[model samples]
Target: MVNRWASGSLAQRGQANRLSHGAAIMPVLLIVGGGLFGSQAAAYARSRGIEARVFDASLEGAASPAAAGLFKEAWAGKRLAEHYRRAIPVLDRLYGIRGVTLKNDDGEDESFQCVPPSAILEKKPVLAKVTAVGDGWLETESQRHEGWVYIAAGIWCQQFLPELAISGKAGAAFAFPGEQPGTIHAIAPGRQAIAFVRDPGFTHFSDGTAERDYAQEHEQATLSRAAALGLTDTPVMRFWGYRPYTPGGPVFRRIGERTWLATGGRKMGTIVGASFACRLVENELRA
Candidate 1:
């Protein structure tokens, strides 16, 4: 049976794990979609002494590159919460995550870097910014690590796995204006304090016609919400992309006896689904 739910690390463990214990080389697993999920999958597999190749059209509007790079924890629903638990530690170990927050008591903004496992395992705050002293104030340090830029990560995977395939498409999907770095806030709807990403327009896209009009509508709605929240300065960026969804949720479909279809990441493709898919495929191949 193949285990499901997805999305690792490097260094002293050896950046490349294609061969270990003088074992035979592993077979290459072909993963489609170069978004966050695919990149994470490839990276995870490489670290486990498995060879994996990722392919993406890299078309304009592809979700990964256009993504705001928000890494958030899921608090609702057992399935998603579990995915978050599995992914967070591994992602943090491999790539240090930068913490950002506009919420503070000193009326000052702050940022910090962290490795999740170290923070989690040691039960200590690695780079936490203290907002209060005594009692509850110390709890913030236990949480750390979350974020990604899929496109650049895919490129990095190629460096680690030289034979990895990452063919660029002809047309670029989205356009990023201005050279200055910008901030994109992740807001979780309702009572949850965690900021998860959910674009109703993209998540509910019906066909090709939707994207042509999505920008204007998305901007207007975002602005309205921002205004209501008194966050008028929040920048809204729009892009078009395609995402595949399966009713059974993401799974590893065995194609014949050798190949497998690792997809169905849906909205959580980048952070949760992608990582899970990669690991699932890696384990199957090893078995």
Candidate 2:
């Protein structure tokens, strides 16, 4: 289903709204970040007998910029098709946690096969456990597909909402395509573009004009930056997210032995920060 949000009502919460509690005094989850990843982690911890608390100073970041530029990943094959293929696993993680589901008009199941990243940067590999819920189908990489759109990138806490997202250190703009109701299709840009990890530990891509680049690139600098990044203008949410440089990372750091130190998340204050808090709590519990 192609969905786009036509109205930004005050009462409306994006798909990432906080879940309600079952009873009073849920265990404390203590998440340090506040973006999408942070929210998901906090929600995950909460479901596992923890109450979530996210911390970040900047909420409005580049992802929210009005004219932030964007492009699709550098995929060689059918770009959107390949993107959906690659996004299945990540979406699976999100679905497992969020209990999300996607189906065709006839209420039939949908699936995608092995999807790979458009380009592999020099970043560490990441993984999550996989389990087949229904009849398995063979994807090039792995089978067991569920029908839903997917995009591959590092997850973050600040990716939750523009408000919770720490403000982007760099300014950017995004042109949103309002197609289906409540769905984010694509984004056009205007500046140098911003690239960094979000608070939750996922990479962020957006069209931005660097404070420094402004002098040289002028009004339409984001287009040049977009081309340089090799982005392909795929149908993903134009959310640039924030860069929370909160007092230096391991946001939940310790100064002494039997202690931990955390801060930073130069860009990813949400997920990393919240993860830091949860890790600390876990260590403390173990201690």
Candidate 3:
């Protein structure tokens, strides 16, 4: 059965307001970056009859594509309890979550997988870098866009808001030759190595390494964990990216009359992104 979220009816309804008089002139949402945060904002905007366009240069070390798309409530902990609750419903409405069993050496574990960002985004991002931004407007190399501006630039967001102390935690996830059974093996007492089918046709593995000064040793250690899982074949692909971190926690706030900034997804990009997207569209934008 086709899930309502994945159906074309929602897209058609999203465009319904465009045909209305006066509403047709509503400001378009100009989003910077095409990673999880930015894409989620765009998707939510579309659902609410707000037009949105995403500008992304597809810079190296983007975290969204590398994400395993797996998340659980425990990962959010107590501090992010509200975000976890808000995000799950939005994620479920946009992209149905599937429960999967993860086999571990000690026992079995449970996790949930949301569809990747590429699957939820309504359109491909315009391959451009936003050169400048202000209240309700932003400029690229040759064109200027005027609308509601949302900056979800991940770690590179520091360039836009120089005063905010933002940093990147880097890591790599490797994909082996063939499909493998889902498993989570302990890499350390608190850390675990994950082997799952994050993408079709490959087995994805990551050792949950998050380091500010990521080096060759970190990469080797991740590979070692994959080897311990008996995945010794030459990795078919390697995904390297940085998860943005803020001193306090995830950030979502209005920066200008019509501009909002969100980042600091860290290891919880999917949930944080969806939660912020809801706040941006439902509360901030519409209200």
Candidate 4:
């Protein structure tokens, strides 16, 4: 009664200040690498109203761009059945999967593809190399950032968590001048080689090759398979990259209070990335 202004105006100001402070301290997701895992995480974070930024050095031998973007539930097998199920919805929502039939000598193979555009991330990556990371912060050569750090550095993730036994299976896919009809031809007895249009204006070919030591012989073998599909002409481009493999399976784990790590996509980078993205955004961060 004696001092109404002091109680009323001061109380409103205090509430506003607290709200502002809370907003200021809200965690941003700091993603390292701009490949499938990092990009998917950034996209999911934005959908959940969490700020996110990607840092990538755009190092050669990243597997995401080279991926055929083809997948089927049967390919996941028993171990990754749950991952396949969880990944489909997120992939459909973010990138829009489409059904396609892969014609082969035996018959036809039914599968789905999600060919994300070249610019899949919301914004361009920071284009900086992340030199170090901790519980809630990361540093580039020139600056430091504080946030919920996520390391999705693909094969290079071993540099951060040295205890984890990570290895790379390197392979190459070739691209011809024009789009070719979709087909899958037998490369080996049970394995199939795919020759189809993945990127627009180019025909793509890849035999299921994951070699620890990629050599000219491996390249020749891939080319021989491509020739079997009548892709004999000199290729306009070759996509070479390393797929990361872990001992058990794909990894998605929290390493620190505000830090997480994920890798080991292997041949299933697209599905694994999307599934981990959903888990990180919908479960871990939100919880």
What is each predicted model's overall lDDT from 0 to 1?
0.38, 0.31, 0.83, 0.82
Worst 10 residues of 4 by lDDT: 1-10
Candidate 4 residue lDDT tens string, 53-119: 9999889998888788888887788988989999998988877886666787877665656554353
Candidate 2 residue 219 C-alpha distance from true site, Å? 6.6
Q: Order the candidates by lDDT, highest first.
A: 3, 4, 1, 2
Tens-digit lDDT track for model 1 on 40-104? 66667667766555444444455454343444563224656766667666666556565644332
Q: TM per model?
A: 0.49, 0.33, 0.89, 0.89
lDDT of 2 by residue, 89-203 (tens): 3334433212212232354542312111111111221222122111111011243222111111122322322123222244443332322111121234322234332222333
TM-score of 1: 0.49
lDDT of 1 at 9: 22
TM-score of 2: 0.33
CA shift at 170, candidate 2, in angstroms? 1.7
Candidate 4: Cα lDDT at 234: 97
Estimate, for each residue in 1-287, the C-alpha lDDT of model 3 and write its tens digit: 11111233334334533755536557789999999999989988998899899999889988887787778887788978899999998888888786766887867666656565456553689999888776666788889777788999999887777777988999999989898888988767656788887778988888889999999999998898899898999998899999999989998878776789999999889999999999999898889
- Pairs with backbone N, CA or C atoms under 3 Å apart (clashes), candidate 4: none
Q: Model 3 clash pairs?
A: none
Determine which window of 10 residues in candidate 2 has minimal summed lDDT.
131-140
Q: How many backbone overlaps does candidate 4 show?
A: 0
